[model samples]
Target: MAFVIHMPLTNTKAATRYAAELPMRETSPGHYEGYYTATSNVRATGATVEVRAQDDYGNTASEIAKGKLNIN
Candidate 1:
């Protein structure tokens, strides 16, 4: 099983690059999605997902999501 992460980008000028600690998927411009697949042998409890955004002008922003999912 896989958990999907959705991060919405409201401000464009402030965010030019998107990166996630997990695998990153670009659903569209300025939008990103990722999957949780760490510790395949153990069940995933409360996990934290971080999404970072950086602009060319050196501005940056980040968002974090924490939740528990059944992935056994």
Candidate 2:
């Protein structure tokens, strides 16, 4: 499934400089992977994973994945 992850933005400067598009990789049919490396080390709180899908006709849709991230 295609997904969008909204990682919390901590550093204002980094947030402002954040890339507008995430470079996604296709793992399988209709599945994609993307990653973000924080400019600084920080913990994640209330993190969530969002999935999106689009058709050749230019129609699109999205949904949030189930689960939480535990970084220690």
Candidate 3:
């Protein structure tokens, strides 16, 4: 099985929920989902999301999602 991790982004509040490595639950095989309410407001381009994954075999992969923050 593979596990996913979300790296938290630093904020002005010293540390928010995004300040630690949050793990996403594997809803189904190979599918993971995570839900979190924003603790503070973010500008249209002020948010960054990083995703990482590791397999039971010790293989690891990571990526920083590149996109504008959609404040709607």
lDDT of 1 by residue, 1-72 (tens): 112234322234454245223446568986777654334344444544556666679786776655644444
**Can you tell me which runs of candidate 1 are displaced by over 4 Å?**
1-20, 23-25, 36-39
Query: Which lDDT values do the candidates have, in the order given?
Result: 0.47, 0.63, 0.56
Worst 10 contiguous positions by lDDT, candidate 2: 1-10
Over the stretch 1-72, how does candidate 3's per-residue lDDT look in tens digits?
Answer: 222223334446567564556668889887887654544754334455667787779898877767634443
Model 3 residue 24 CA deviation in Å: 0.4
Candidate 1 has an lDDT of 0.47
Please give each candidate's TM-score. Answer: 0.46, 0.60, 0.56
Clashes of each: 0, 0, 0
Q: Give the Cα-based TM-score of candidate 1 against the true structure.
A: 0.46
> Which lDDT value does model 3 have at 70?
48
Kindly report the root-mean-square deviation of model 2 from the true structure over all alpha carbons: 3.1
**Model 3 worst lDDT window (10 residues):** 1-10
Query: Residue 56 in candidate 2 has what lDDT?
Result: 88
By TM-score, is 1 or 2 better? 2
Ranking by TM-score: 2, 3, 1
Q: Which candidate do you rate higher for lDDT, 2 or 3?
A: 2
Better of 1 and 3 by TM-score: 3
